[model samples]
Target chain A: MTLDLDTARRLIAGTRSAAHERGLKPLTVVVLDAGGHVVAAEREDGSSAKRFEIAHGKAYGAVSMGLGSRALMDRAEQQPYFIAAVTSAVGGSLVPVPGGVLVRDGDGTLLGAVGVTGDTSDNDEAAAVAGIGAAGLTAQPAA
Target chain B: MTLDLDTARRLIAGTRSAAHERGLKPLTVVVLDAGGHVVAAEREDGSSAKRFEIAHGKAYGAVSMGLGSRALMDRAEQQPYFIAAVTSAVGGSLVPVPGGVLVRDGDGTLLGAVGVTGDTSDNDEAAAVAGIGAAGLTAQPAA
Candidate 1:
């Protein structure tokens, strides 16, 4: 099923609340539908200008690749040139980062992805996981 | 004064409904906030693959220039070389087409922009205007 607007907004709210509770920096969160299109996005006050783009890139990359961005990051580490080529192929929209997490339903069906930016990669990932959990969804991050 | 998520979704739905009523082709619509960031976007089934990007480019260009895409199209016609240079400088994100319309609040404050792509440029413009009106907002196209 498609990730509806209400779910996407809830995901963003959850991510923002988790970021606040953890004392992370202002964050930008983006949710992309299964078709790799933006469903909803929000940039918290004090977030940098590029945070939205970065967050969107991460979510788009995850949905396009059908894997969490952490997996892409791991692959990029081993094959930087390949990842660069992929980036060029996609017109520079791919972001191999840790903050992108895949969203799945209870039956393991892919819904979409959530990407966060503005803090350390690990912290961003944590917030994403917490947000997905708070929304009662599954976050499938790369091992 | 912001384009909240609910407003953005309403604009998209209104655009889709207008397109359907007019018997236009499948369309992709995008709404950008005042900061030129995507608030919501959707590509209808059977729409072309690049419709989302084109719609987003049109909306972003409108918000960035604080005018409608029709105005940008006029400017491009008068100064093709300068417009080309600007397009190149922005990595080709600006679409000087007729489908982008500026959205304004009742108080005449700029809220954001909506872009629609699928049918002819004129039809797209009509759909964008109809969508904004249905959402109880003003669409400020060039005079």
Candidate 2:
């Protein structure tokens, strides 16, 4: 089933909760449905102005490429030109970063994606994983 | 002064409350700082996928023109070519229509803007005005 607004808000809250527990920097979180449309989003106070776009791009990339952004990062490293072209194809809304995670259901059905920005990329990934876990879903960060 | 995240959330809540009280359709709301950066944004469950972009464009257009989108609409009708060129100049992020209201402080300082979409444009503008009022800010929908 497609992600719903209630679940999207929960995902956003869980992401922020994880960041708060870790004492990480204020973050921006974005939840996108399987079709890469935003379901919900929030930016904590003090986050940089561009964090929303960065967070949205990460999640959009995950859904558009059908892979976690960590894998996208690997591909980018191996084939920069290819990634660049794909990024252009997506209207420059792809970020090859680790903070973007794919969400899946028990039946291995892709539900949506969550993207986080604020802390280091790895830390952001950790937060995203925690959020997905908190939402009772699986987070795929690579492969 | 710039609009903070807390106030932005309040405005969003207020906008939704107004829509609910009036039994309006599901809506998308966007808050943008004076610099035209997103502070916060949300789309209700049933809103169309592109509501966020439309809402954002309404607010961005208001702040960019230093007037409410109602005025922008008037200018667009009076000078279609100019509005069209300006829309292209802003990367096509300007929506000349109602439902985009400028936010101002007591001292008449421009703080930010709010955009709403889903219902009729007039109803959307009403909700936006209600939201700004709830946040204790003034809403300028014309001039």
Candidate 3:
């Protein structure tokens, strides 16, 4: 199923609120649909310029691999060369970071993924999880 | 000003409608903020897999150069070696095509750009112009 625009917007808003509540640095949030295409994205004022590209790379990696970026990070650690090859093949859009989370519907159908950047990786992951939850979706890491 | 999600969605919808009216091939549309960050994008069913990337490249080239892709195409034709070098420097994310158009506000402030693919260059440019107009924005080519 496709990731609806409303949910994507809600995810962005939720992520922003989560970051604000924690007093984290400005963030860039990106949501990619099931086809690994951008649905919505936002870069908060004062965010580092690279945050948007980082967020997009994380989301692209998650959707393209059908796994959360954390899972990719773990796999990359063991297979560095493989990840490097894949990154180069995809024009360097894969980011094996902790902040990319896969979104699933109630039936466990893949909806998309949300990627957050501009803070610690752990904090970014936490905000992404909260945002997915706020959008009434489950955040599932790859098994 | 940045390209907001609402305006991006409207642009996509407008482009889709234009394509349908003209019986063009399925299209992929991408919008980038003034900072050259993707704001939103959509790839219609039946569009080629690379359409999204092509659309994004067109939009990125437009916003990054502060000119429509048609203008870039003209320049590239006159300065092929320089354009090639610049495209290589940017990692091949620049598409100097007619489909990329700059978005501007009423007072002529650049907001972002819209790129359309999956049709003839002229048709794609027409759809992009229609999309920008539908969003209540101006589509300005470089002087």
Candidate 4:
């Protein structure tokens, strides 16, 4: 239920390495705890104003759904009427897309999550996977 | 940095899972892209409206400064005037407090950031970290 600062640092470092390996463009990473609260956040220079919100939303959507944004998007597609109505009702923070997942210990203990932006969802997902492994945790694939 | 739909879901899924496991109250998680734009967002059904803005502002601040909210809060202490000015200048999307970190990659690429506010700073950071890992990225430490 708790996240350590040392672990968080490792998570970021791992993500950075993965991104560079792939030669992805500038990216932003975020960490959230199990309680669905903010843990750590960052933005890169030249990142647009909207980028901040977009990153947050992408990750938020993934965290909220307990699945990758792409999976959620697929679910939303199956129920367009409900999804559209929910989006309209919620206004902000409800994103239907891919590129996010859940972080769990080997025993399936919850350990919070990580989100990445500034690239394709596939790349973002790839980076997230890399970070989770660096942190010594497991990334549950989208269902 | 560009924020996409895939990463959005990852952030939310991790955050929510953390909350669900920890028995924290219902929460609203928000992720912001590098440009401060909303890439994805999600609020727990029982969460209040206040959570939405708090999450947005905190995440926005993290991305805006390329650091976590906790780090930003510390800096604000040294320059209260500047922090206050930013709050007033950019309303509803800049909570200068602890709990959020800047999103970054291994090579220090700027992607996007995330923010959460349903719990304390520590809890917030936890959720943020969970989100980051869920997305396969890393969150920077508060400097």
Worst 10 residues of 1 chain A by lDDT: A37-46
Query: Which 10 residues in a row give candidate 1 chain B its minimum summed lDDT?
Result: B41-50
Model 4 CA lDDT for position B45 = 47
Candidate 3 at A88: error in angstroms? 4.0
DockQ, every prediction = 0.24, 0.57, 0.26, 0.09
Candidate 1 CAPRI level: acceptable
TM-score of each: 0.73, 0.96, 0.74, 0.52
Per-residue lDDT tens digits for candidate 2, residues A74-142, read: 999999998889988887589998999999988889999999999999999999999999999999988
lDDT of the structure predicted as candidate 3: 0.83
| Candidate with best lDDT | 2
Model 4: per-residue lDDT, tens digit, B44-132?
A: 64555457668778888877777788887887889988888877776655777765656666677767777776767787778778667
lDDT of 3 by residue, A47-132 (tens): 76567789988888898889899999998999989778888887658899799899999999998899999999989989999888
Write the residue-wise lDDT of candidate 4 on A1-143 in tens digits.
24544465567668768888998876666665565444454444344555554655666666665666677678788987865676566555755655465678889876766767778877877887888898889885365
Minimal lDDT window, size 10, model 4 chain A: A38-47
Rank candidates by TM-score, best first: 2, 3, 1, 4
Error of 2 at A111 (Å): 1.9
Question: Per-residue CA lDDT of candidate 1, range A41-100, in tens?
Answer: 666656775677899888878888888999999999999997788888876587898998
- State how far residue A44 of model 1 sits from its true place (Å): 6.6
- Fraction of the reference Cα-Cα interface contacts (below 8 Å) that each candidate reproduces: 0.18, 0.53, 0.20, 0.10
State the TM-score for model 3.
Answer: 0.74
How would you encode candidate 2's per-residue C-alpha lDDT over B26-45 as one tens digit per residue? 99999998988888788898
TM-score of chain B of 1: 0.95
